[model samples]
Target chain A: MSEAIQPRMIDFKPHEIPLEDFDISQRELWSEDLKMAYFERLREEAPVHYCKDSEFGPYWSVTRYADIMEVDSNWQDFSSEPAITIIDPEEDFPLPMFIAMDPPKHDDQRKTVQGSVAPANLKNLESTIRGRVQTVLDELPVGEEFDWVDRVSIELTTQMLATLFDFPFEDRRKLTRWSDVATGGPETGVVETEEQRREELMECLAYFTRLWQERQEQGLSNDFISMLAHGEATKDMSPEEYLGNLILLIVGGNDTTRNSMTGGVLALNENPGEYAKLRNNPGVIPNMVSEIIRWQTPLAHMRRIANRDYELGGQTIKQGDKVIMWYLSGNRDERAIENPNEFIIDRKRARQHLSFGFGPHRCMGNRLAELQLRILWEEIQKRFHMVEVVGEVERVPSNFVHGYTKMPVVLHPL
Target chain B: MPKITYIEHNGTQHEVDAEVGVSVMQAAIDNLVPGIDADCGGECSCATCHVMVKEDWVAKTGSPEEGEESMLDLNPERQGNSRLSCQITVTEELDGLIVDLPEFQF
Candidate 1:
């Protein structure tokens, strides 16, 4: 057994560490050396460390699983208003959705959008979504290498989301780019020029505006956008508000699911025994889906505002203070998950992951996300004998979203 | 058996026999209604069981409790007649109660 390292104070002021020192654009979230170092540090001192200065601002980072659950569940104390990401919007472009709002009004806006993506609606999409996944996989280049992130993961998820909104098929990739710009700006790669980012945002809004107008002119249909366009939520949704909700759904549904697919395949490649176990017992796909979500935890963290002064983990949190719940860390909490680090498919409590988040603001598209993942695995198993990671797996630089930017895999078809 | 009617978001109505003493949410789940998930198992924690009480059946269902009221504050389509299905217990008087499913419940 490794000895537990003693707790020591380490200041994580953002400004103290220059942005250039951290390769935010690199595919590996942390260089392998850094990842191991940080995980070790988290297991020891300051599981709930405070950073004095970050690019966004000073905030508390809740790294433990139990601590994240406590904060996520207790929304009365830790509100979802002001902002939901660690980087303050003023310092960066703001996320326009009301996922950041608090009670009363938050409830109203949520109700409007919830009508379209509820579980029942998701169930109806199962076969359609599954078929779409199969179709995407069926077209893959048999023995050749390709950027799985772009060709498979992004294409499949973006198409599914576009189908959900009844968007034109040819323009679906735009949805992917917009979401990339919206969430990818703060983390790494080409920092989108302010004008380029603005253009993308406007493009997204204009697309939704046109859709809303068409729906209004015609009538409500089966699509989510139509449902939102004519439903109770729209009674008060201004053009901008409608566009904001559309963007929220697109982002919520896109990266998280795409990453899980990429992550699940990558995890299987890394653990061949587990992959063989899955191939032998196809019955374990459902459980395996949950495990992948837990292991990958595509969305790393979500921020909440303290409604009032409260105390947690022996520290006092003033009202309106920012609290960052690291869901990735929470999903691997040693207290909540057994053998937290290992990728165990049959672990009974695997579904109890913070990846979908918890409480009211939990993911709206969780069921759809899971369905897509399960189908992807099922199709992959039927068509391919093996998936080998031919090269290094790249991770997005931003702390908010976690997943590969480029995962080159060579598919071996049976 | 009490007859209850559920009008889905698309205006499709499902009429079924509901047992007395079970909440509307339980009735929907018992009948395998498509939209009512009740993911939190009727704890009023997840707003998945949200239903709109028909105007005529308001008195039979009674007003939402303080907790239900607060919980409803988190729902997106909350209306004047919005009630959490878990909070309402079935009674013979509510045999013909009508409830409408919202278009979305995440």
Candidate 2:
């Protein structure tokens, strides 16, 4: 609320806008929830549309399901280095995390910590996650309106993140604050200035460094700090690199799931049929989790730099062009998904969506995310008849982190 | 049509007839077999369609190529006989093929 985003689009329908004038990367469109119409137009007319100018500069939008798959899977052709968002990496304060790095290094670093959050490992954490979900649900006031985003979504995700990192239980909100600062710039009001953002992040690194040293002195444990401290590939990382990976894990585990949590409740309220379907058959929660992920599309787009001149969707993209794979757009592609806009609780092949991206860079926490959501919904169904939305839902004003800011809700018992 | 037997983790076996050219992943999906989730469709990009060929039938299924190997390598559950079903095309040579589905798809 520090400053209003500069208005870029006039009151014209997305279809009325000239194809050349489409630059869907603007933050205003995301906050206003008007980016979908723009993406719909791009998918129909120009699956691989290029915007000559945008707030983030020139970039090409891969708006189709098949085309996004091609770009995301072909890492040799389109690299993730330098940056993974439309905004270029800060030159002075470069964060060399593996998500933005290409193979060999990316593979090695990812594998070292990957074991902790892998699906096999998640089975052991299921009870712990379920207990936390139950605790959160049990504490909420029945029939009383409250901010669901803060009470349930943020509370549950932050608690789970704390358990994963072995972070301090009382100071868990710091993880939420840090996740926001890492992805958001001063423009979004996470901090007053660029320097303040860096300073807070440094404080985060210093805090984690203490835990890393403590873990290094002990036997290898199951927590993330212990895994990183003992991991051969990650043990030698520099301070900046460690901070980069920390930010990556925090944001990856936090904002994405938090949004989906609120998004699912909102979606269920909006579509009563689906909510009824969920009530009748609680077994559909697992499938509904995938559908919710697709519907939310927590991260709207992942940017890549073309490594060589490649022809995609009948357009020649230069070697140095910035390419954005709009996962939100692809998840709604009618060509790939049947009735892409509707939220069907029992949609077949629900997991086949670009929300996680694909190939090596596909989300490492996909299973962990699913497990949490499954447990939450399963527990929610057992207790509440309906978690009714009571008022206006506010959304986060960033195209990169597609999520909610507030959703007021009240729980009703069966 | 070649006959493919997909054994789920819980010992449930689904024997389905497959077309001559579709993938083993497609066969399971088409037959409504429960375990395999070919998230990438028939593309070798996503290793979600992971399956372990029964020891007796491993040779007939053939080894995974380099691209397929890279995808399978990303999975922590990958075993020595592990393969991406999407990479395995159905054929007469794959008749009576038996593949064991993992407990979970990565």
What DockQ, between 0 and 1, does each candidate earn? 0.21, 0.72
User: Candidate 2 docking: what grade?
Assistant: medium
> Residue by residue across A170-256, what tens digits does model 1's lDDT show?
999989888888775422543435567667788888887888789778877878777776777555576656656777788888989
Per-residue CA lDDT of candidate 2, range A1-414, in tens?
343554555565798878999988887788789999999999999999989998789999999999999999999999999779889988999988889999878988888788888888898999999999999999999999999999999999999999999999999999999999999987776788889999999999999999999999999998888988998989999998999999999999999999999999999999999999999999899999999999999999999999999999999999999999999999999999999999998998898898988988999998899999999999999999999999999988898999999999999998
- CA displacement after TM-score superposition, residue A384 of candidate 2 (Å): 1.2
Among these predictions, the greatest DockQ belongs to 2
Candidate 1: where are CA atoms >4 Å away?
A1-36, A91-95, B1-106
Q: What is the TM-score of chain A in candidate 2?
A: 0.98
Off by over 4 Å in 2: A1-10
Assess chain B of each prediction and give its TM-score: 0.95, 0.96
Q: DockQ score for model 2, please? A: 0.72
Interface RMSD, per-candidate values to 1 decimal: 4.3, 1.0
